[model samples]
Target chain A: MHFMTALRAAWQQRDSLLCVGLDPDPARFPAHLQGRSDAILRFCTQIVDATADLVCCFKPQIAYFAAHRAEDQLEALVEHIHARHPGTPVVLDAKRGDIGSTAEQYAIEAFERFKADAITVNPYMGRDSVDPYLAYPDKGVILLCRTSNPGGSDLQFLEVDTSKGRMKLYEHVARTVAEDWNASGNCALVVGATFPAEIARVRALVGELPLLVPGIGAQGGDIAATLAAGRTENGTGLMINSSRAVLYAGKGEDFAEAARRVAEETRDAINAYR
Target chain B: MHFMTALRAAWQQRDSLLCVGLDPDPARFPAHLQGRSDAILRFCTQIVDATADLVCCFKPQIAYFAAHRAEDQLEALVEHIHARHPGTPVVLDAKRGDIGSTAEQYAIEAFERFKADAITVNPYMGRDSVDPYLAYPDKGVILLCRTSNPGGSDLQFLEVDTSKGRMKLYEHVARTVAEDWNASGNCALVVGATFPAEIARVRALVGELPLLVPGIGAQGGDIAATLAAGRTENGTGLMINSSRAVLYAGKGEDFAEAARRVAEETRDAINAYR
Candidate 1:
C-alpha cells in the first residue's frame, strides 16, 4: 500500500495522530520480560498489541534494537505489526542520511529489510542523500527539520541564504522540501511538537504535508499547542510520537494494559484538540 | 587501546594511511560467491584478510550489512580484523545522528554491539546529539563537515554566522568541532577528498585533529591534492578511505587479490604524495 494513502487512512479510520515509538529499552522492561532472550521483541509486540488500535503509526527506533543485537527481532516486530494491525503505518525512526548508493542501502534496510511504511531521514546532507528513499514511491520519507533538542539550534537555527532570501537553516530546509524536494509528493517534515511556533512556521511553508512531531510525552510538549500550530485544513496530519512515557508506563504484569490506558488517553487528548 | 593511539600506531606501523572500507554489495560479488548464504561475510573477510597488513584502519559501512540483514556478519568481520590484524582500528562508517539516550543506543550499537574502535557520525544536530558518543573517551568520533557530493555544497557552502564571522556551514562545523566539541580530544572531521581547497580550509581550521577523507577511488577524487590540503603538521593525521574501487576491483577467483592490489596502490599513491 502507498504510505501516504495508508497514513491518511490511518488518521481518518483510527481518528489518531499518536505515533507510539517502539524504543525497547530492555533494562527498563517489566521484571517478567527482562533478560529473556526475546525480551525486545516480546516487550515491543505487547506494546503494539495494546495500542495498535489507537495510533496512526508505530515508530520503531532501530538503534535500540541494534544496541541489543536484536535487529532480527526488529524485523520480526515490523512483520508482527503488519500481520496483526493492518493499516497502521510503521515509520522506522532511523534518522538515516547518506548520499547515493549508501543512501539506497539504508533505504533497503528500512523499507525492504524491516518493511517500514516510512522512515525518518536526516536532511543535513541535502537533496541527493534523500533521493534514494524518495525513489521508493510508495514509501514515505520524513526529513528532520526543526528538532526538539536544545542543541538542535546549534546548526539548524543558523542564518543561511536561500532563493527566497536569508532564512534560518531549518526554514530553508522547510521551504526547499515544500517547494523543490517533495517531487513525488511522498515527503514529510519532522517538526518537533515542542516547537509549536516552528511547527506553525513549517506548516505554513509546506501546506498539507504530514509532520512526524516527536517530543510530546517525555519531552514535555503540549498537544493543544501542537494541534493549534500544525493541524492541516482538515484538522489532521501529525503523528505525535511518545516513547519513554508510553513504553515504560508500567512495570508490572499489567504493563500492556497500562500502555493501552496511556495510549487511549493520549490519542483521545490529541482528538480533543481537533 | 585508545582509538587515537591505535590509529597513529597503525599509520606508522603499516606505513599506510589507507582506510579500506568494507562495503559489500552481494550482486557485485564473484559469480561463484553470488547466491551463497555467507557471500557477504566470505567476500568481506577475504578482502580484509587480503589487505589486513596494508591499512591504518578498516571502515565497514554499516548500511551494506543492515540492508542485507548481515549485521552479525559485520560483527564477525570486525572481530576478524581485530583478531587477525591486532593494531588496525575499525571505524564503523555509520554517520548516525540523534539526541541524548537515542545517541547512547547508537553509541552502544557502534562501540558495544559491533565493538568498533571508532565511528563516523553526523554533526548536524549539534553538541548535545554528539555528546553520548564522545562519552566513550577512548573511541574516536568523526563528524561530517564538507561531504564529497554535488549536493553537499547545497547546504554546506552556504554562508552562516559564526562567532568569529560569517562563514560557510561546513566551516562553522569545522571550527566548532575544532574548538569546542573535541573536549574529549576524540573528535575528527570528514572533509571529502573531492574538494581539495575546502579540505585545506578544514585542515587550517582544525589544526592537529585527524580528518577522514573519503571520495577517492570510484568517486573520482585526487589523492595528491587531498594529501596536500588535508595532511596534518606531521603529515600523519588523515585516514583516506576508498570503498568500491578497492572492494570490487575484481569479480573472479582472484577478486580478493585484486582488492589487495587496489588497496596497495591506493596506500602507495597516498604515501607518494606524503
Candidate 2:
C-alpha cells in the first residue's frame, strides 16, 4: 500500500492521531536494556507490539541510534515492527537537510537503509536540499517550520516582508514548500503545538497539506488549542507527536503496557476534537 | 592545543588560508581504487601526504564517507592524516543540527567518532540545538549562513525585522550565533563565497569569528571578490574551501599529485588576497 493509504488505515483502526516518538536515550532506556543493541531492539519490539494498536504511527529519532553506530540495528528494528504489523507507518525523525548530492545520500540512508514511510527534515538549507527526499512518490517529507524548543522563537517568528505583505518567517517557508517544492510527491510541515495562533496561520499558508504537530505532552502545550488550530476538516491530516511523555511512561518491566495507556489517552484526546 | 591556537599555527606554516575538501565520490574515485574501503583510505592518505604542506587543513565531507556506511574506515582515515602530519586540522563537513540531546550525539560522532577538529552545522534548529556542540571547548562549530548552492538565495537572503534593526535572515543567524550561542567556546560562521556583499555584511556583524568560506573552485565564485568581502583586518580568520577542483584533479594513479598542484595554486590565490 502507498504511505498515505497505510497511514489512513492505521489512524482509522487505532482511533489515533497520536504518533509516539521512540527517541531512546541510552540513559533513559529501561535499566535492564542499557548498553545492548539487542535489548534496545527488544524493548522497541515490545513497545511497538503494545502501542501499535493505539498509535497512528511510530517515530524513531535517528540520532539516538546513530550515536551508538546502531544505525543498521535500528533499521532492523523498524523493519521488524513493519513486518509484525504491516499497516503501521514509521517516521524516521532525522532532521537532515543539505545540498542536492548530500541529500540524495541521506535519502538512501532513510528510505533504503531504514525503509521509513516518512522522515523529518530541516529546511534551513533551502529547497534544493530537500528536493531529493521529496522525489520519492510514496514517502513523506515533513519540513521543519516552527520547532518546540525555547530558543526556536529566536528566528522562526521573525517578521519578514514578502511580495504578499509582512509575514512570519515560517509562513514564507510554509508557502514556499507548499506551492513550489511539493510538486513531485508527499510533503508536510512540522509546526510546533506550543504556538497555536502561528499554527493556524501556517495552516492557512499550507492549505491542505498534512502537518506533523509536535510539543503536545512533555512540552506543556495545550491539546485543546493545538487541535483547534490544526485539525483538518477530515480529521486525518495532523500527526500529533508525543515523545518522552509516552515512551518513558514507566521505568519497570510493564513499561510497554504503560506506554499503551498513555498512547490511548493521547488518541482519545485527539478523537475528542472530532 | 585549543582550536584557535592550532588553527593559527597551521595558517602560518601553510602561508595560505585554504582547505581542500576530500569528498571522494565512489563514482569519481580513481578507477583502480573503486569498490575498496582500503583504496579510498589510501587515496585520502596520499592526498594528505601530498598537500599536507600546501593547505591549512583537509575537510572530508562526511556525507561521502557516511553514504558508504564506512564510518569506522573514515575514522581511521582521520587518524592516519593526523599521525602522518601532526598539526593539520581535519574539518568534518557534516551539516548536522537537532535538539540539545541529539546534538550532543552528533558532537560525539564528529569529535569522537571521526576526531574532527571542527564540524559544520545547520543553525535552523536554533540556539539550544547548537549549544551542545559548542560545549566542547576545543571543537569548532561552523554555522551555515549563506551556502554556495545556486538556490541558496531562496531563504538566506530574506529580510527580517529584528530587535536590533532590519537584517538578512543569514545575517540574523550570524548575529544570534556569534552573540548568544558562543558562550561555551569555539564558534564560527560559514559565509559562502557566492554572495560577496552578504559575506562582508555578516563579517561585520559577527566580529572576529573565523569564517569558513566555501564555493571557491567548482562553484564559479570569484576568488578576489570573496577575499575582499571575507578578509578580517589581520587576514587570519578565513578558511576558504575547495573540493571538486582539487580532489577530482585526475582520474588515474597520478591523482594525488594533481590534487596537490591545484591545492597549491588555490592556496597561492587565497594568500595573494592579503
Candidate 3:
C-alpha cells in the first residue's frame, strides 16, 4: 500500500493524530526498570502497549537507541510495534543525509534493515542526497522545514533570491519539496508545532501533505494553534509527536497506566481541535 | 590534544593529505571474503593496516557499517586505527544533524561511542542543532559547504542576504563557521574537490580553517586543482578523501597490497601539488 494512504487509513481507523516518540532514555527510566539490560525495550513496549490505540504512528529517534548501544533493541521495538498494531506506522527519526552510494546505504539502513514505514532526513546536501530515499515509493521521507529550536533561524531565516522573489530558506524548502521533490507523493515536511504561522504557511504551500510536528507537550507548543494551522480539509494531516511527556508521564510502578492516561488526554485534546 | 592539532600533527608525520574512506560494502567485497560474516570488519581493517602509513587520516562512513549491521565492526575498526597508528585521525563520516537533547545523544554516539576525532554534520538546522557537537572543544565538526555532487547546487548556490551583503549560501556557511561558529577552533568545511573554483571560493571565505575534500577518486575531481585552491598559506589545510579508488584497487588475495599502492600514488599526487 502507498505510505500516505496507509497513514490516512491509520488516522481514520484510530481517529487520532498523536505520534508517540519512543526515545527511551535509560537514565530517565522508572526505578524498577532501571538496572535491567532490556529496560529500553521493556519500557518502550509497555508504552507501545498502552498507547497503540491512541496514536496515528510511532517515531523512534535512532540516536537514543544508538547512544545506549542498543540498535538491536530498536530493531526489536519496531517489530513489537508492527506485531502489536499493524495499523500504526513507524518513522525512524534518523535525520540522515549524504551523497550517492553512501545515501543509498543509509536508505537501506532505515528502510531495509530497520523496517521503518517512513524516515526523517536532513536536506542540507541537496537533491541527490534525498533522491535515494525517494526511490522507496512506499516509504515516506520527511524533511525539516521550520524547526522548533530557538537557533533554527540561524540559517533557516536567511532571505534567498528565488524565482518567486526573496523568501526565507525554510519557505524555499517547503516550495521545493511540494513541487519538485514529491513526484512519489510520499514526501512530507517537518514544520514545528511551536511555529503555528510557519506551519500554516508550509501547509498552504504543500497542500494536503502531512507534517510531523515535534514541539508539543514537553516542548510547550499550543495544541489548538497547531491543529488550526496544520490539519487538512478533512481534519487529519499532522503527526503531532510528544516524547518525554508521554514516555515519562510517571515515575512509579503504575507508569504504563500513567502513560496511557496522558496519551488519551493528549489525543482527546488534539481531537477537540480537529 | 585538540583534533585540529592532532590532524596537523598527522600531516607533519605522514607527509600525506589523503583521507582513505573505509566504506565497507560486502557485495563489492573481493571473492575471498564475499560470503564471510566478518567480511565488513576484516575488509576495512586490512585497508586500515595497508594504508595507515600512506594517509594522514581514515574516514569510516557510518552508513556503510550500519547498513550491514556491522556497527560493532566499526567500533573495533576505530579502536584498531587508534591502536595501529595513534597519530592517525579517524573522522567518522556521519553527517548527523538534530536539535537540543537529541543532538547531545548524537554527540555521544560520534565522540564517545564511535571514538571519532571528527564527524561530518549537516548545517541546515542552524546553530542549536550544531551547538551540541561544537560543545566538544577537543573534537572537530566538519560541515557540508559546497558538495561535489551535481544536485548540491539546488540550494547551496542561492544568493542569501547576509550582514556582509548578498552571498551564496555556501559562502555564508563558510563565513559563519570561520567567524561565529569557531570560538573553540574545532570547525571545518567540506568543499568538494570536483569544484576547484568553489574550493577556492570557500578557502577565501574561511581563511585558514581546514577543508575535508571528497570527490577525489571515484567522483572525478581534479587533484592538482583541488590542492591549489584549497591549501592554506602553509600548504597543509586539506584532507582529500578517496574511497572506491583506494578500497577496490584490487580484487584478489593481494587486494590490500594493491590498495596500498593506489593509496600511496594518490597521496603522492596530492603532495606534489601542495
Candidate 4:
C-alpha cells in the first residue's frame, strides 16, 4: 500500500495522530541499559512495545543510531516494530538532501536498508535532490517546511519574491511542492509544532496533504494551538511527534511504563483538541 | 592544523585545486571487482593510489558507501588517504543537517567514525545545525550554497527581502555565513562549477573563504570559466571536484591508470586556468 493510505489506515485503526520519535541518546537511556551495547535497540523496542497501541506511527531520527554505529540495530528496530505492530508506519527522520545520484543512494539507504515506510528529506538542493525519494510512489517524502529550531528563522522565514509576490521561503517551498511536485500524492510537509502560525500557513497552502508536526512535548509547543492550526479540514492529517518528553520520561526501571503513560496522555490531549 | 591551513598547504604543495570525488557505484565498477564483497574498498584504494599526487583533496560521497553498506570501506579509505598521503585533506561530502544534539551525532559520525578531516554540511536548519560541525575547530565545515543542478534556481534564486534590501536567497546565505558565522575560519561554501556566474557571485560574497566546486567533469561544467569565477584573489581557495569523469574513465583492468590520466588532465586544465 502507498504510504499515505497506510498512514491513514493506521491513524483510523489506532485512533491516534501521535508519532513517537525514537531518538535514543545513550546519556538519557534508563539506568539498566546504560552500558549495554544493544541499549539503543533494547530501549527502542521497549518503547515501541509500551506505546505501540497509542501511536499511529514511529519516527526514528537516524543521527542517534549513526552516532553509535548502531545502524544494524536501527534496521532491527524497524523490522521489530513492523512485526510487533504490523500496521503502524515508520518514518525515518533523516532530512537528507543531495545531488541526483547521491539522493538515489540515500533513498535506498532509508527505504531498502532501513525499511522505513516514509522518510524526511531537505529541499535545500531543489527538485532533483528531492525527486529520487519522491520517485518511490509507494513511500512518503516529508519535506522540511518551517522547522522548529531557534535558527529555523535564519533562512526559512526569509521573504522571497515569487510569481505570487513576496512570501516566506517556507511558504514558497509549500506552494512549489504542493503544486509542481506531489503528482504521486505521497508528499508531505514537516511544520514544527512550535510554530503554529507557520503550521497554519502551511496547512492553508497544502490542503489535506499530511503534515508531520515535531517539537510538541519537550520543545514547549502549545498542544491545543498546534492541533488547531495543523489539523486538516477533516481533522485527521497531522502527525504530532514527541521524542525526548516521551522517550526519557523516567530514568529508572519503570521507564517503559512511564513512557506509556506519557504517550497515553499526549495521544488523549491531541484527541481532545481534534 | 586547521582545515583551511591544511587545505592551503596541500594546494601549494600539489600546485593544484583538484578534488577527486570517490563515489563508487557498484553497478559502474569494473568487471574484475564486480562481485567482490570488498569492491568498494579495492576500487577506492586503487583510485586514491593512482591519483593521490594529482589532487589537493579527496572527497568520498557518503551516500555511495552508505548505499552498499560499505561505511567500513569509507572509514578504511580515509585512513588509507591519511596514511599514504598525509598532507592531502579528505573532505567527506555528507551534507548533513539536524537539531543541536542530532547534529552532534552526525559530527561524531563524520569526524570520529570516518575520520574525515573536513565534512560538507547543509545549512537549512541555520546556525545551530551548522554550529556542531563548526565546534571542532580543527575540522572544516563546507556549507551548501548554490548547487550545480538545474533545479538549483527553484528556491535559491528567489529574491528575498533582507536587511540589505532584496537579494537572492543564496546571497543571503553567503552574507549571513560569511559575516555572522565563520569565527573559527573553518567554514566554506559549496558553489557548483556548472553555474560559473553563481560561483563568481558566491566568490565575491565570501571573500577569501574556500569553495568546494563540484559538477566539473561529468556534469559538463566549463573548466576555464570555473577557475576564473571561483578562484580567490590570490588564485587559490577553490577545491574543484569531479567524480564520474575521473572514476569511470575506463571499464577494464587499466581503469586505475585511466583514472590517473584523467585526474592529471583535469588538474593540468585547472592549473592552466589559474
Candidates in order, interface RMSD in Å: 0.8, 1.2, 0.8, 0.7
Local distance difference test, each candidate: 0.92, 0.83, 0.92, 0.91
Model 2 global lDDT (CA atoms, 0 to 1): 0.83
Per-residue C-alpha lDDT of model 2 across residues A149-188, encoded as one tens digit per residue: 7777777889988877888888888998898888864888
DockQ of each: 0.83, 0.66, 0.84, 0.85
lDDT by residue (tens digit), candidate 3, B1-274:
6889989998988998999999888887889999888899899999999999888889999999999888899999999889988879999899888888899999999999999999999998888889999999899999999998988888899999999999999999999999998888999989998899999999988889999999998999999999889999888999999999999999998889999999999999998998
Off by over 4 Å in 4: none
A117-202, model 4: which lDDT tens digit per residue?
Answer: 99999999999899999888899999998888899999999888899888899999999889988988999998998899989999
DockQ, ranked from best to worst:
4, 3, 1, 2
Weakest lDDT window of 10 consecutive positions for candidate 2 chain B: B63-72
- Give candidate 3 regions above 4 Å deviation: none
What is the C-alpha lDDT profile of model 2 across B1-274, one tens digit per residue? 6676778899887787998888767788788898775766778888889888987778998767666776677888899988988888888888887778778888887887778999899988788888888888888888898887766778788899998899889988988888888875588888888888888898888888888988888887888988898888888788999988998898898999899899988988888886
lDDT (10s digit) by residue, model 1, range A1-274 = 9999999999999899999999999889999997799999999999999999899999999899999999899999999999999888999999998878899999999998999999999987888999999999999999999988888989999988777899899999888888998989999989887889999989988989999999999998889999999999898989899998899999998999999999999999999999
Better of 2 and 3 by TM-score: 3
Model 4, position A51: C-alpha lDDT score:
99
